[model samples]
Target: MLSFPSRKHSSLRVALTALTTLAVAGGAAAIPTTSTATPNAAPKSWDETAYRGQVEVVRTPEGPADTEYLTGRVFVDQDRDSASDRRERGLDGVVVSNGRDVVTTDRHGRYRLPAYDNMTVFITQPAGYQVPVDESNVAQFHYNHLPEGSPELRYGGIAPTGPLPDAVNFPLVRSQLTRAQEQHCVIAGDLQTYDRTEVEYARQGAINDLAGRRDYQGCGTLFIGDVVGDDLSLYPDVKDLTSLTNGPARFLPGNHDLDFDSATAEHAFDTFRAQMAPAYYSYDVGDVHIVALNTVRYPCTPDVDNADGRRPECDDPENSPRYNGRLDENQLAWLEQDLAAVDDDKLVVVAGHIPLLTFADEGSAIHQVDQVREVYELLEGREAVSVAGHTHSIENMRTGDLVQGWQDLFGVEGLPFPHITAGAISGDWYSGELTENGYPVAVGRDGGRPGLLTLDIRGDSFRERYTVTGESDRVQTQLGINSPTYRDWYAERQAWNDNPEGAAPELGDPHVVIREDLAGQTWLTTNFWMGSTGSTVEVEIDGRRAGEATRTQEMRGEDQLIGPEWSDPHAVAQQLVHGGSVADRTMHLWRFELPADLGTGRHRAEVTATDAHGREYTDVLHFRVVDQP
Candidate 1:
């Protein structure tokens, strides 16, 4: 986990890793193999101070000059034995650039290159190397370019066009984690390091992000789950990774974290517990009660034949994979007790790996629990929000009780609770190629760029912002509604898009105008997933109030968790198989009639939505009404 001292060191490691694997041939690119030390060089005393300086890496076409690359300077630990030393030389061949593009150092250990603003330029950890660190045991490396500066790029981030400078340098100094620093929390999901290489990959990916900068030192990072793949041995590596973070780090359990050797529910997460602490617990942070839950139950299906089926002890466990995803009765009971203790006015944020509901394939199954609504019902009227990760996608669905889209099956309509899918820290399982920054450019399922989620919790009201990878600013809201036309298009597209090995067309622009044919029996529908079951949707026409709406879910059975529990097969298949309406009412589909006797002028239709807690959200739609001849 704690691989190197600074971001430069880690990037150098990734660079070494990548270079080592590269097919170094005549035609293939020759990565600069520079070394910080010479054959006759003396082993200088190690510097003890953290390195603090500016650094920037830019992308450019192959230069006309033989030495088109630039040479930049970065300090090693400055205070050697607590005193400033002039003997240290710049680290050689430190890979630096935004993750996509890269550049190496000159003989003197200096690096220079074209400029790219608002980019995160970091060092690619050279293989078999280290960097400077502060007294608090946190690494001090990596540099950021807010080209337009910080606290102001609230609009779209750095401009792509350049008025760039020639150089950016980083300074080094020893420092300690301070209590007075503002608390910045890093929320990471599923490191899931499978092997040593993956462990290093994980280290290189996040360590660079953690190296420099001042934010996230107080609250530290809270990894939601799946710290390693099925192998639990990577926990120590995860610990090492967190040690590099500027603040305290915590974790929750994911499905893969379960003890494969365990025979019963009680001993299910023993391995995970041994490595990352308790499976289910809670802590207080800045007026927020963060509860980490272990939703994966050992034997997915409880067998009456097994001894102590109700409360099976781990010591004499029963081996079964029946419980791929779920919160056992005991944990549910614990949650009820834990939540009951919190003050109604205080904010309670429930964090877990498997979401209560999600847009992924196993959404209803491994995604959420059958009793999810029951849990939300308990939190009703309280300041609360649910956050989970397993889906590896960024989804922010407002909660309400009007079932139309995905919520039709459960018969639970309206806002039940606001549930957020915290997209993975290893976005798309870290599947992309290395960026010059030495990290992967992993994207989300919803096409939302990935990085992390930041919740600015101030008292009862909390604002969530999704910080996309590579982009400094966050996308606050994902607009677009579910109407009959878009629904039909989605249906046609989904049914024929199953070619696994074939090239596919784009899912189309995520941002689009959802066309709706309001004439005839057509209606404008909104499916607030399960969390919106108890919420309300208010429709207003031309400044006049229209009506209030409710959400509905299709319930299958008392034991069912995901998918269409009580779903009518027709409605459930409609998203993939379109036709006439199904027998059961689908809450994800909302219908609104166009007023009669209207002319061909543009009119505004405002839809105001209120969640279970009475929080109001307003969305205005522009449509035209034409007269029939």
Candidate 2:
């Protein structure tokens, strides 16, 4: 999800190029706008792009000159239309922002802050209210303010506004979506559609699955980024797919959805805002406050010696199209204020495309946030949890689960709250064989089956569950036996796959292991999709206690270990033979080292997974231990 371009262009040069192209096309670009009565005092260009960039209308405070402040009002839409009506009165206590600065509406429902250019002005959706959505089901909650439109860019970066507007008002419709404490929040990660074909795959897969389900109409489904694979034109296709959701659909920008050809970072996500969503925004439902952050920073300039020992001789960010995960100073400041306004008892659900810390990509500095500790500090003592995607793995990392990268890069040790990677719907970019439903079985990198994560919330507390595509909730564990024969087959398959001329490696009986294979090297592995710190996996051999299995990664600030020993044999056996990321090391794999004295007969290990919340699930696996053949 990088946007590092081959070359850099100056802002002026970018502007000139845009102007020339528009002139040649015989039309300056056009933006989409909805019809609204009782709109603000009209005077400027009606172009939706330019209109969206207009500064909030003038507000002459009874204060000083150097103290310029932004002004806005939040009103209840008496009529369901998006515009504010005269009969519609102001709604007090509604929070608004200029990216970093946060302010609440006064008694009259008006807010003011120091105004600035290139700032995204938005209103946080209050409890008992819902923001409007465009035809694509994208939430409408913010306005972009820029004096001049984007520099030379593809996907038509925002057109210039030239000046501030007379007034900027947000209208909220009374909705059941945000009024209750009980909620089902839908979280889908990494749609990552590459083209029309993949778009159809999404439709048949998660989209179709979502279509049949009538749940989550209130909390709605939020698609965390990597919405598309670098192609801005596919935005319409992306929207078409989103229409399948039974509830309101919203989006967050990912690195992949950037205008890489843009001249400045300011215009980087302009196309995303233009087509899919705001750079970032927030909304409220029940006791949970969802703060969606734009954590992707493009063209991330690295120091002379990058800390990534894994990738030495790395090219400069300017020379490569890499992106770093970071929250801008403004967003961070805004977050502090936003949190300050919220009651500590309220559950804060922070969502972003890139994770703050992950069991996957622990060594790469750019993959995780640079200021995770700061975010943690802002939410300190508050009941909170985070959701992210980008690693294409499902991880349910709970509090006290240490991330070594956080300690090394940000000096953070244990997770303050649960951090989950919702797992990508694209499922390894829609890799592997097509199912009868006309979709691929794109298993995830950590061997998690492609699925959507749902948060069943009551008050500030919640229970998280992952529902695999085309499967029921009971299918949570993936069972496999890690044996010498399988490991040998793994190595041999890799060697053959590396050569185009080599014959295909066949995976014989997957559940068969000989007595010789039972040396201390063999073990029973289980990839529990929703497994976390307090979770336990107990193995019973033919109804007897074989003892609790040890988790592969303790997540206690230790280094990550990968390879055959850490791999999910069940996932790899199929993923490698089909097509998908290898089921290598994962955060959820638990193994029970097989005893050397077991009998040489087909035996069953009953695994009972008990989560941190005490909910339990059972799964079984059968394997044979014949005499050495």
Candidate 3:
């Protein structure tokens, strides 16, 4: 059995020291320490002294006046209060928006935009200046305006704001933490908690991990989507999870976080916007401009012709409404305006609930953005990285990576830049047996463990890393042997599952291979969770010279390699025996063929994996070979 370390908290000093030792010993470079000292210097610690509050909403005089426009001011919070004071001066040239029109603050730090009935007005948090955060460490930079309130719904939507305010001012504080060149930004995927029980499971797993770490307080944690399951009532409990985090918590709405009771596409996420964040928004930290897009279209109508023979469900909305991976026209228009304002030198981080394109659902028209080419054209010739979370799998697809499904569905050949499907926090919807930490194993369909993705950024360049929940950063890969016996058992299990039988025969000795099995063909498979095209895996048997292992899916204009032959044996074993999605078909799996002519006995293979970022990790596997059973 695999032995996991205890789930006890480690002091920051101890953790850093251990990490430094590992770095010196030729492991991945130690995570850059955080500090609140200088903009050019690397951070040393969390900015504990930073002011935390919300936006300042100015009340108007009692008189019938012009309500054609909404106004706001962006100012430095001198007294640490959330409100804007008389002496405090407004900061100029900051970008602000009213969900559609993009504008910038004048010399007086004031901005004006056309008024609307139901709109969300927010600021694109400028680099070197941190916005105020609420009690739960959620960044408070937006003002929701719904004069008439939401329509009748099961979960309470936005309450009535009565009338638009005279001024809705935003507060900011100077933060060296946000100004630092080096940043560790956390991108957490589906924390799709269905009930209070799942909330506790999250609390004990990834939540606990974030609470203990202080390195990401600057760029902070951006939960990329699916904050909760279908039940929007659990949003408060999810907020409780964020309260335990050391950084500012931001969110993007997912398909599951929708209000199914809504009658139209416009009000589908009213409740989510009321409780969480805007359906879509953008912010800046250092040189990175993060554009969080609302990519889920509810009650979606067919935007593209049926020539591709996809998304037939999108034909009707009133009687049979369904959500699809698409951006509305308004959002698209706003995206164009948003990108126009950003400087070409800045790195653009395009984040959304549904991916612009993904390897997991590359073939599904409903699971990928409908207007993907438009987005690519808009971001053409600029440093960009796309991150999304809908498919509960981890995919680190780099630039030029191609798949047949993308070409067939979207008429796209290869990726323009890196695109990552950050694995789900509620791994496979929290399926499988519980671990010692009181959470489900819930291994992903791609054999990736439940985890969070961290983008360690320096200037316009970044390196991605995945930290499995309740495990150390070193646990990057899962090793197993795929022999003839396991293959036979996989077929047997699939057939038995199709037709219920008295009992299913369990495959014995998964780590053992007989002479005949070796002759038939056996492979040592490595499931490198975050491995990408540039990553490499090598195996050394009995201290012999190491030979490079071949990646199963080369991702060079090829279709998905699926089914039992390409499955992860270790993950499949748990999934079939206990519960969870089967581990089959992944872009990151690598295999090394075992020699057919080998002496029968115990054998040990030392495997080493070097990631795209050149971070090295090592694992060992021991298996036995015999002449007979």
Report backbone clashes per prediction.
Answer: 100, 10, 6
| lDDT (Cα, tens digit) per residue for candidate 1, span 1-629 | 11111211111122323322221100111111222111121122122222322223333564323233223455454544322235755555444443223455544455554434433444533322333344333333344433344222212222333333333443333233222112234677667777777777666655545553235443446788887887776666777776666554567888777666554555566555544545666544444566777776765543421223332322232442454456766567656655554555556677878776654433244355555677777787666778888777655556552323235333455545566776666765665456676656554443233466655444445645444444332122212323344445454445455543454323232222222244433333333321233456666768776776433332221222222222222122332332222222222323344454444666666655554334454555565443321
Tens digits of lDDT, candidate 3, 1-629: 11112322222211222211211101122121221111232244444544688888877576225588887789998888888887988987677778887777777788777779989999999989999887788889898999899998789889988888878899899888788767778999999999999999999999998887877888999998889998999988988999898788999999988888898888899999999899999998887889999989886776542335598878777688888888888889888878877777677899998999988887898899989999999999788999999999999999999999999988998999999999989988899999999999998899889999988777667778788898777778888888888888888887776786889868887887878988776998999888999999999988888999999999899999998779888888777777778888999999999988778999988888888766678888888999997
What's the lDDT for candidate 2? 0.76
**After superposition, candidate 2 runs with Cα above 4 Å error:** 1-70, 303-315, 595-601
User: Model 1, 603: alpha-carbon shift in Å?
Assistant: 27
Q: How many steric overlaps does candidate 1 have?
A: 100
TM-score of every model?
0.48, 0.85, 0.92
> In candidate 2, which residue pairs clash?
4-321, 14-152, 57-165, 57-166, 57-167, 69-113, 70-113, 100-330, 100-334, 149-160
**lDDT of each prediction vs. the true structure?**
0.48, 0.76, 0.83
Q: How close is candidate 3 to the true structure, as a TM-score?
A: 0.92
Top candidate when judged by lDDT against the true structure:
3
Q: Which stretches of candidate 1 lie over 4 Å from their true place?
A: 1-184, 302-320, 361-363, 401-411, 474-629
Tens-place lDDT per residue, model 2, 515-615, is 88887589888888898899888888887765999999888888887898899998898788887889878989999988788897888877777777666
RMSD per candidate (Å) reads 21.4, 12.8, 9.3
Where is the poorest 10-residue window by lDDT in model 3? 18-27
